[model samples]
Target: MRLSQSLIPTIKEVPSEAQIASHRLMLRAGLVRQTSAGIYAWLPAGLRLLNNIADIVREEQDAAGAQEVLMPTIQPATLWQESGRYEDYGKEMLRIKDRHERDMLYGPTNEEMITDLYRQSVKSYKELPQVAYQIQWKFRDEVRPRFGVMRGREFYMKDAYSFDIDYEGAFVTYRRMMLAYMRTFQRLGVKAIPMVADTGPIGGDLSHEFIILAPTGESQVFYDAAFEDVDYGAANFDSAKPDDLGRFFGIMTDNYAATEEKHDLDVWGKIDDSRKREGRGIEIGHIFYFGTKYSKAMNFAVTGPDGQKLFPEMGSYGIGVSRMAGALIEASHDEAGIIWPDSVAPFKAAILNLKQGDPTTDALCEDLYGKLRKVALYDDRSERAGVKFADADLMGHPWQIIIGPRGAANGLVELKRRATGEREELSLDAALAKIGLNAS
Candidate 1:
């Protein structure tokens, strides 16, 4: 993309309302603009990052055997009433009335709606183990929405529902989801620890919150230090048998980890000093096994092998797709701006024509831009060299390739890595070799 005609409206000073580094950087980098108290309009640059994160989430969900589907943002309140949560779910629920005076709501979650959908069509154990997921906007109407997208009232989410005939089957499905979440975070260049968590309004007996340690995070967490080094990707889950799933579950559960709401002082004291670690963490994803909570309430039943009708055991998994943008910035930013992970950076590299008007520099940048269409951003703006360099850093592309008259004359250009702040002078061919077609 060429910055000369792009819609990135970057600013020089931080907004007073932004309280954290990620929030400030997001504003200054022109990634998003606030539409209301907690609602935002994602600009071109931010939307690119959002789509990348959603792609990762979809890939992981598909690998775990979940099929993707789209659900409506506005749902009839009758479903919530059927689940006996219409009165239970408090003010956060954005209740409304339609022309016929029927109760309607902007869904905060989709348990009730998904249960109603399943009950209407699925009638037997033949479809016993099915998982459906959707990526859509959700609203909670937070009383004090703040911290940008991190705690926004309106945000995007990836929510999946799993249905099984019995408790044992449901547990296996839950384990698959847990492993998938771990791998998803790892691929996004973040280490997220799974900690036992309170389900809150989403009632359930079993729940786990995937959290990443950050000093400015809202949740306090305690865990074994060994969790920091565990590699979920290396675990052989793809070819594992049913029994192997049980073993993997046991190995992960044997470790100690919990959020402050579920933390136990006795368990913390039992661990050796070297193994104990406490820190603040941001909650990025959550999974829960709610047995027949939604199915029974909404009359979602399937016939068992013995010819008896039974409510299907069910579970839900959620990832805050929009909130992850803020979480990533919180975990990986420096004084200059966000240090985006290469996997999710909007552009792999920014090709800055330091002397834009110079014929040699222009020709070199244009050539490089044409050759690397998929992974390059050509900065052809008529801005000062210093301004262009600062904007490139603030935008957080993984690399910056600078071309100037002097460098072009000498058959050399500069390549700089955003994360490490390392630079190298190399020939045009060598520079392209260093950052291949799919470098990001």
Candidate 2:
């Protein structure tokens, strides 16, 4: 994408309303524009990042055997009523009335709706152990919506529902989702610690809120340093076997990881000082294991193997898909701007034509851009070197390939890694090799 004609309306100064690094950088980088108190319009760069995050979230969920299904943003209020949470959900639920005077709402979460879908179809125990998820937009009118997308009224979410025949099945599903969450965050390039958390509106005794450590996080957290070395990509935990899943779940819960709300100093004291790790953390995702909570209230029943009617155990897992883009910045940014991890960066690299009009620089940039247009963000604007360099850093492409008249003529260009601030002067071929551009 060419910045000369892109919609990335980057600003020189930070907005006063942005309280955190993520919100401030998001505004200055022109990733998103606020339309209202808690509503935002994701610009080109922001949308690309959002989609990238969503794609990875989808991949991990699928890998964990969760089938994808797109759900609607608008839901009928009757579903909530059937679950006895119509009035209990409070004003955060955007209650509405259509022209026909039927009660409805913009769903904050899909627990009730997904449960309703399950009950309508799939009878008998044979359909048990089904997990379905959706990557969709959700809304909850926050009383004080601040901190940009992290606490927004409207946001994208990956909410999945699991239906099982019994508590044992639901527990296994919970761990499967847990494994999926860990891998997802691992790929997203953040060390998200799973902490015991309150289920809140979702309503479940077994719940965990995955929190990523950040200097400017909302809540203080205490965790074990052992969590740092556990590799999700390696060491497979077979979710199919009860014993394997049980062991995985045990390790996660046994670790001394908790937020201020659930912290126990007695438990914290037992851990060795060397193993104790403490920091502020931002909640990235959540998983729950609520057995028969919705199925019982909504009268969702299926026939058991013994021909007896039984309520299917259910659980809900959620990831704040839109909030993740903001969280990534919070977890990984410097004084200049966001330091996007390559796996989720909007663009792979930014090709800077330092002297745009110079024939040598122009030709070199054009050739590089043509070779990498699919993954490169080309800065071809007629701007000063300072302005272009600053904007490139603010956007935080994983790499910046600088081409000047002198360097272009010599078949050499400068390469800078955004995360490490490492710069190398090398031939164009060497620069391409560093960014893994072997073709063309």
Candidate 3:
């Protein structure tokens, strides 16, 4: 993609309304544009990043045996009413009436609706241990919508619901989802620690919130440094095995990790001084095991193997697909702009034609761009080198290939890594190789 022909409208001045680094950088870097007080339109680069995150979440969920399904954004009020939460759900829900005066709502969560769907299809224990998930837009009319996408009125999310025949099955599903969440965050290049959390509105006695560390986070958190040593990617745990999941759960719970609200000083003092770690953290995902809550409320039942009717145990897992963009920037950005991790970066690298009109520079940049066009951005605009550099940094591509007259003439290209302000002049092949590219 050529910047001259692209839609990345990076701004020189930060918007006054942005309160956090992520919010400010998102707008200045042309990731999103606010169409309303708390609603936004994701531009090209922003949407690409969002899709990348969603893809990883989908992959991990699939690996955990969760089937992907698309659910409606607008849900009937009857579902909430059946669950006895319609009037008590508070004002954040956007309730509406359709042509025939039927009460409807833009769903904030799909607990009731998913339960209804599950009851309609599965009539026996043969379909036990089912998990369904969807990645879709959700809305909650926040009283004071602020902080860009972080606390927006409308956002994208991945919400999964699990149904099991009994408590034991539900617990296994919960642990499986837990492992899936850890793996998902790990693949996204973020260190998300799971902590015991209150189950608000979700109505479950057992709950955990996955929080990622960031200096500008909403809450102070205390955790054990041992969490840092657990390599989730290479862990030997198997989701299908109960013993493995039990061990995984034990490892997670053995560590003392809690947000400020739940922090216990008595417990904190018992840990080894060197193992203590404290930092601010942002909540990126949550998991809850609310056994039979929805099934009992909605009269959802299936025949057991012993020919007895039973209400299926249930759980719900959620990850804020859109909020992650803000949380990621909050964790990884610097004063200049966002330093995107390679897994979720919109573009892998940028090709900068420092001397756009110079024949040698232009030729070298064009050749590199042609080779890496799918994963790169070519800055071919008639702009000064300083302007190109500033925009490149603000856009935060993982690598930048600088083509100048001097470097191009000598068959050399300057490669710079965005995370660290490190640059090296190398032969074209070596530069591409260092950037993890091939001569395909």
Please list the Cα RMSD from the true structure of every candidate, rounded to 1 decimal place.
1.8, 1.4, 1.3
Q: Candidate 3 lDDT, tens digit per residue, 81-173? A: 999989988999999999999999999999999999988899999988899999999999999999999999999999999999989899878
TM-score (all chains, Cα) for each model? 0.96, 0.97, 0.98
lDDT of 1 by residue, 279-314 (tens): 888999999999999998988898888899989999
True lDDT of residue 32, candidate 1: 97
| Greater-lDDT candidate between 2 and 3 | 3
**Runs off by more than 4 Å, candidate 1:** 240-248, 438-440
Which model, 1 or 2, shows the larger lDDT?
Answer: 2
The candidate 3 region of ten consecutive residues with least summed lDDT is 233-242
lDDT of 2: 0.90
Q: Rate the local accuracy (lDDT) of all candidates.
A: 0.89, 0.90, 0.92
Cα lDDT tens digits, model 2, 1-440, are 99989999999898999999999999999999999999999999999999999999999988888899988888998899999899999999899999999999999999898888888998999988999999999999999999999999999999999999988888878888988898899999999899888889899799999999888889999999878867777525544455755555666777789999889999899999999998999998998888888999999999999999999999999999999999999999999999999999999999999997899889989988998998999999999999999999999999999999999989999999999989999998888998887536
RMSD of 3: 1.3
